[model samples]
Target: MALMITDECINCDVCEPECPNDAISMGAEIYVIDPGKCTECVGHFDEPQCIQVCPVECIPKNPEHLESPEQLMQKYHALVTAKNDA
Candidate 1:
C-alpha cells in the first residue's frame, strides 16, 4: 500500500529526503505524501525509508490508496523508467 503522512507530522522535513521516489513534500499545512508517486520504497529498500526516519511516526499505510506489493513494484518500475527517460 502507498503510505500517507498524517496530521501528526511535525514538519521536521526529515521524511521528504528519505523518500526515494520524491513522493513526499510540504503541503499547505504539513508534509504530504503523493500516492501516485509513492511506491513505499519498494524499488529502493526492503522497507519504507520515510517511515523508518520519521521521528513523529506520522507516516502510515494509506487505506484510501490500498495496493499490494506487486502493484507497488510495478509502480516502482514505471517510476524508474520515467526517470531514466527524462
Candidate 2:
C-alpha cells in the first residue's frame, strides 16, 4: 500500500529524503505523499523508510491506494524502468 502523510505532520523534513520512490514532497502546508509514486519501499526496504524516520508518526497506509505486496513490487519495477529510460 502507498503511504500518506497525515495533517499531524510537523514538517520535520525527515520523511521526504527517506522516500526511496521520491513520493513525498512539500505541500502547501505540510508534506504530501504522491500515491502513484509510492510503493511503500517494497523494492528498496522491508519496511517504509519514511515511516521509520518520521518523528510525528504521521505516515500511514493510504486506504484509497491499497495494493498487495506483489503489486507494489510490480510498481517498483515500473518505476525503476521508467527512471532508467529517462
lDDT of 2 by residue, 6-67 (tens): 99999999989989889999999999999999999999999899989988899989999979
Residue 69 lDDT, candidate 1, scale 0-100: 92
Instruction: Please give, for residues 1-86, the per-residue lDDT of candidate 1 as tens digits.
Output: 89999999889988899889999999999999999999999979999999899998999899999899999999999999999999
Cand. 1 Cα-lDDT: 0.93
Model 1 error, position 64 (Å): 0.6
Residue 84 of model 1 has an lDDT of 100
**Candidate 1: pairs in clash:** none
**How many clashes show up in model 1?**
0
TM-score of each: 0.97, 0.97
